[model samples]
Target chain A: MTKPADTGMTEASAPVILGQNSGPLSRAISRLRGHSFAVANLLMAPTMLWLLLFLALPLGVILVYSFGSRGTYGDVIYGFAFDNYLRAFSPIWLPVILRSFLFAGIATALTLAMGYPLAYFIAIYGGRRKSIYLILVMVPFWTSYLIRTYSWIVILRSQGVVNTILQWANIIDNPLDLLNTPFSVILGLTYGFLPFMTLPLYASLEKLDKSLIEAAWDLGASRIWALLTVTIPLSIPGIIAGTLLVFIPAVGDFVTPDLLGGPDTLMIGNVIQQQFLSARDWAYGSALSFSLMAILLIGIFLYVRKVGTENLA
Target chain B: MNDGTPSTIEQCEDCAIRLEGVTKRFGDFTAVEKMDLGIRRGEFFSLLGPSGCGKTTTLRMIAGFEEPSEGAILLDGVDVARLPPYRRNVNTVFQNYALFPHLNVEKNVAFGLKRKKLPKDEIATRVADALRMVELGDRATYKPDQLSGGMQQRVALARALVNLPSVLLLDEPLGALDLKLRRQMQLELKHIHKNVGITFIYVTHDQEEALTMSDRIAVMNMGTVEQVGSPEELYESPGSRFVASFIGTSNFIDGVVQWTATEGSIVLGDGERVIIELPEDGSRPVTVELSVRPEKIRLRESGEEVQPGQCMLRGTVRDVVYLGMTTQYSLHIPSLDRVFSVLEQNVEIASDQTLWVSGEEAILTWHPSHNRMLPSSGA
Candidate 1:
């Protein structure tokens, strides 16, 4: 074998400098300690640049546009005006905003109802196959969300697989009106966000000290009572996190409504899309978007104030 | 085979809980073999053993967490093998002190009482009383995370004790405390047991803790109980080698019986003999192992007179360990090829002229009654 590097080196043979304050090595150590602030700034530069370029610039443009007037040709005319915000708060948009909230709230409730038990099973009773079950939960995300929404269309259309099966079974004389309905939209939203709710619930339930449940049982609480008193209360953080994650996005979701909702089920997202793409009123669209953000922020603020932000995992 | 104790069924009449041939097995491995035990009313009983010795398993069976694979567990003279944990009148103080993090100290203590749907005033008064018992009366509003580990342990105790169950099972409740706190908690727990007058079944791996707190102890090994007795009885006469070595420092000498001499003296092989008093009709000519406690062996200086009824052996001192309370001497006897330990109290200074040092010949002497003989097989 070849001789290894530093074979001749020993601790005593290493160089030692006298007058520690004046040595280059001592200067280097002092500089390293004092340069930590500069190093932290450098480490954060990329993220700051990305946020400024993508998020801040777009939001600033929207804020500026919201104050301008809509031009004759549907282009944004640069002029100070409050007409767009005034129209945003008018009764014309009330139904759409309320509808969005209704759909989001129902979908969130449905997702939580279905997700908690599934997460509890995987975390508490899955045993050695926990990783495999978690992988199965995430497997549906590999497909594009658009393809998944389109697949629902294929399943729910009047002449699609579901109606065909029902007709074959003679369950009904005519196909049910399943497509382009608010029910279908809610179903789509629940399916899309189910994993988001389950993962956090699983994380919180998995880290729970199992002995608390045992102690509850030992304290004369039955199985159902123990679950309600100990397991559910301890998992409030996961419930809050999952609700925020599903509700915030489902409020602004346009795809599921665009494909699966009817005219009667128009949410604020569809209204904003119409303003931008069909009506070509960029200022009005920006105003609606800012209004939605403000409402969501206020709702989130009240929620966090009520539940306490420290509980968020 | 009778140790002069009453049968388990007869004992169960007045006992708080009794286990009759309880056996627990998990698939291919047995966690606890056939176990028969009874805990008397208002008694502090301890199941003492090392890890995986089935002490905790036996406690769990009594608490209704595990059902015995073979036999029944009786609580208050009624079989509770089919009862769920919630239906059983027992509470467990978990080793981790699993106090609810979300609930404040008062609410945690009131959990079981509230489940019983007691009146609101009754619940409040009981919760206050329980908190005061654990010396946590002022910290009622503090969450479990806000308190120290010792305080959390006290809260766990209060929560379990507030229900006033028929039996209280503590699974090494003080195993997580530091040395000083653990000692303090041991005394406090014993005091609480006396004040509550509840049957306490404690499980621990610390032999000293068991000795300090238990009124009766069952020493278990290899998923089976080796011996059961009071602390003094078990310490004075351990039934098996495992119990002797596990409970305290014991020196064992292996030899075959050569002959039975009159007046309860037995001659051993290689012309060695010991004066152990035995009954007149006792059997002989079988191999035997002798166990002696280190404190029982006296280190005699040169020219020390040997009294009658005292058996003596000469050995060379190999090493010395100076503990604070006592000094242990390791003596090597060349003829028997064994090292025997002798413990002496450190009341006298080591510089005294009578003290023996390493490599010095010393005579080890003890009374014949101090020698305990067990069969070689140890059953």
Candidate 2:
């Protein structure tokens, strides 16, 4: 970039004048620079159009519908009403919201508790086997998520491998009640989101300066103290990233609950899915979809505000 | 218990660290060969070597970051060979200044004190003292990323110093800084050494840095100590060709010993005889390489040259580099392809291209003392 401009100025082929002419070549190059800026702006036009049309338009539609009335046959009616939001906060809906939060929170916490050690082990001690370990973490992700979740049914069912093993081991007299419960749902969600929790945390932990830990050790901190004060604190961004990844997706997840959870432990996602397909209430479904999206958006907003946007390039 | 511990600490102050035939090996590669080194109380010692020469491994062994494959390390008269790094009373200022990016400067400096569970006020006072020591008191509120390289290095130093460890291990602490800042910090480090009076084990590949600041330097090569001496001693009388070459520029002349006199001097195969003191119970025809420092060799009027003494090599100036204070001459001698010579700027080398080059060849003389016998090349 610097060389071409110097060449242009150096290869002077103009009539000698009191002042340099700033000739047609220079003008053309300057015009080319202007055209390049315009081209760059033109390059962004489609993406701008995409955000405005698809993203902003859909969000606008949802926002409008959130405030509007519901028609008799479950269609959005274009009249202002706060009933859906009010209904979202009603005593009847509180249990569902609380249940979603509890499930997601438990899943997030469990994912972190399990994933962090795995990530830390991979980063610190996996050595030449690091890629193989990482591949193992990603293997479950390769199988279709639904298929993996369904495979849990095979393992958790009455005659499944887990029950058979337990029976063989004499730990249980009968096949245990493992599937179709909140525990199963939580287990399924944790299994599904393990990779999501591990990869980013692994990335952050891998990039962590080993010298910081050494510095901690130098400061007379025990290994556990060093990890708690230095390693864990430094890895918070990864924790936040992993938590949001697990929690947001698990909150809106219907498949895990549908396959593994009992009717008594049904989450908001299962209810929303039932509202759309079984109940055939499109208005309430849209409202429920909007609600899930709102929660996810808020989670993402907090995540970005706290860790992502503050440091991410 | 406190009285006994204090007495123990007092009695153990003579040798800050001692390594007994320590050897570190990673797989088949020997990072540190069987080595013995002792660091005295409150001394600034540098482990000087090129990259992969195991200077860092030695320092890490001392810091308890690495365990020796053989032998033990005694810290303050106590066997700390198997102790974890956290259990050792040693701190390391890592090369990149490895400050916790999430912590502000004050918090970074205070990190060690926090780990020790010091009183809050004590931690604050010590952190302030550390920051002030590094002249970074005003930047306490800034995070590591907010500071420049020099400031970051100071923060690392402060973090290490605040702990008041029995020893401070600086692993190329200024290696990451720019040249000007590096020089500035080198002096700053020397001042810190003077102020703190703690045993410092600094590791660096830079010869000049090691020469400038260390109380004693251990010159290492190929996972072995080449020589150990003060800067002047190492530069003036290197024990091997490696040390001679590594410490400063030198001209090596390889020749066959033709004859020996009662004194150590000998005659070469080409009838270019020179004299040097001989070792007791000398053997004959012992082939040896002669090491000559560049600055010690001078050019003079050819015919008026002093009688050839211990060693002399006829060489011509091939090129000249005119540095502001001193001039460097690249001389080409048939013995060795090239030899470098540093001379004062006023020592004019006239451009009469065919000028005879010889001087009081006595300064070029080598003694049995000066001649460092090295393994003969497999010619």
Candidate 3:
């Protein structure tokens, strides 16, 4: 879009200066030369329009709704009130929030514990097969995340593949209860987010200099010591990135918990979903979402400040 | 432990590191082949070669980073082939410095010492002393990336030296530096080796770096050691054609031995005879190649008085390269159809008079003893 304007400016300026004309056309050409701001704004128009319509406008509507009230007959009434936010902190909803934090935290930890070694293996020892290993890590994404989560249910449910195998092997007289629990929720969250954690970890680990590990080992560090002192410290950026990638979405995840969790394993996402769709309380749902966003932003802000922005991957 | 004092003559006789027929193979390709070498106590020994010539593989074997596929490596008279790098009594200064980006200079230097679980006071003192040795004492709190390239290299040196291992293996530690910084670090490294009195096994592809810093050098080629000698010995009396060509620039005159005598001579392809001093055994090979250093050849005007026992070749000056300290004249002999380089020192000659015009007849002469014979197997 800017190409013709640039050529026009060059071609027009030459004739205007050579002819020494100060007419309206020449003045307009000079003004066009000084209006690069307008050109830049034009270039940014598509992204600005996208953010305004899809991101900022939706966020503004949510913010406004969080302060409004819920009407009878399941409709939103336009009125300023802090009742939704106040109710979010009440004893009735505190357990749900706490449960979501616990599930997200455990899932993030599990993902990190599993992803770090896989990333290390791919980065350090994969050799010429590194791309193959990376593709294998990403192969789960070829199927829908929802289908992958459902497959775990097929494996973990009583009388499913795992329980049937265990019974046929005669290792258990009774099938253990593995599905519809907090364990299943955390497992589903971890399985869904494992690739998210592994990719950033791989990126950071791949960027780490192999010589540093050798230098550490040369300086009298054992293999484990070198991994702890040199490898782990150098991959801190990957760790932070992987944590944020897994933890943020895991906290706000509704589908995994809704599909896998029992009645006793309710999370804040389930509460928000109920408020918005079943209870028809959009204000309360917005309040819950805003609170989650605020808490997550604050936590991320503190973490980045501690680790320093320059260390971010 | 010895307070940085020079070792006694008795201690100097001990071999600190020994490679007993060590060979390293990566699958089908051999990186190092049956290399037997001994680095003495308090000696700065260099493994010099072109890239992929097994110089680095030899160093890695000694440092225990690579296990020799055949034979063994010994450190201070003890076989350490089975030991890991941490268990070996040696440290390596990597080419890129390999300073830990997460650690400060002090912590980097103190890394090895802390691994030994030394007392806090001793670790501090030694770390400080090492930083002072590298003249980077003030940059202790700074990370590796915060320092300049040269400073980071010094921190790597200090980090390895703080351990005071029985041997210090340096794999082209100054290879990353610019020429000026490299020269400075070469002197500093030599000085440190003298002070610490540790056996230093250095590896480099740069022949000049090997010549400048090593007390003795092993010139390697194609997974084998071509020749091992002092700098002067390697330059003056290279044992193989590979060593002669790799160490320094040499003018190779290919010819067949005509007759063996006190003053032996070889007949060139054009039937011109050049005088050379044969080996004492007097078993002259059917064909031989002679290496003459460019600096050793003198360019004189025609019909000049030739000293006795001096061989002379007459040719026309094809090109003149006026270097700062010396002017190189490339003489093209019509009979040989080759250009012989003769480097003449511009001691009294002014810069304007140094340019020897092309197509000028010149006589190239060198002492008979300076014509070093190379091995029959040509490189």
* Between candidates 2 and 3, the TM-score winner: 3
The Cα RMSD of model 2 versus the native structure comes to 7.9
- With candidate 3 superimposed using the best TM-score fit, by how many Å does residue B144's alpha carbon deviate from the native? 1.5
Model 3 stretches astray by more than 4 angstroms: A1-49, A307-313, B1-13, B267-272, B350-355
Which sections of candidate 2 miss by over 4 Å?
A1-56, A61-78, A295-313, B1-13, B258-262, B266-271, B280-285, B308-311, B335-379
CA-lDDT, candidates in order: 0.86, 0.78, 0.86
Worst 10 residues of 1 chain B by lDDT: B1-10
User: Looking at model 3 chain B, which ten-residue stretch has the lowest summed lDDT?
Assistant: B1-10
Better of 1 and 2 by DockQ: 2
- At residue A113, what lDDT does model 2 achieve? 98
Candidate 1 per-residue C-alpha lDDT over A1-313 given as tens digits, one digit per residue, 9 for 90 to 100: 1133343354335544334356787888779987997999999999999999999999999999998977899888877788899999999889889999999999999999999999999999999999999999998899999999999999999999999999999998899999899999999999999999999999999999988888888888999999998998889888888999999999999999998989988989998999999999999899999999999999988986677644421
DockQ of 3: 0.39
lDDT of 2 at A264: 67
Measured against the true structure, the TM-scores of the candidates, in listed sequence, are: 0.90, 0.85, 0.90
What lDDT tens digits, residue by residue, belong to model 2 across residues B200-229?
Answer: 999999998999899888888878777777
Alpha-carbon deviation at A296 in model 2, angstroms: 4.7
- Model 3 lDDT, full chain set: 0.86
lDDT of 3 at B205: 92
Candidates sorted on lDDT, descending: 1, 3, 2
Per-residue accuracy of model 3 over B1-379 as CA lDDT, tens digit each: 0112122222334688777788899999999988777778888999999999999988888888888899877788899987999998799999999888878889999999999999999999999999999999899999788999999999998899899999999999888887667777888999998999888989999999899899999888989877777899999988777888898888888776667456667655332457877677667676678898989998878768777667777789988887667777888976567778888888979646646789988778888788888767733
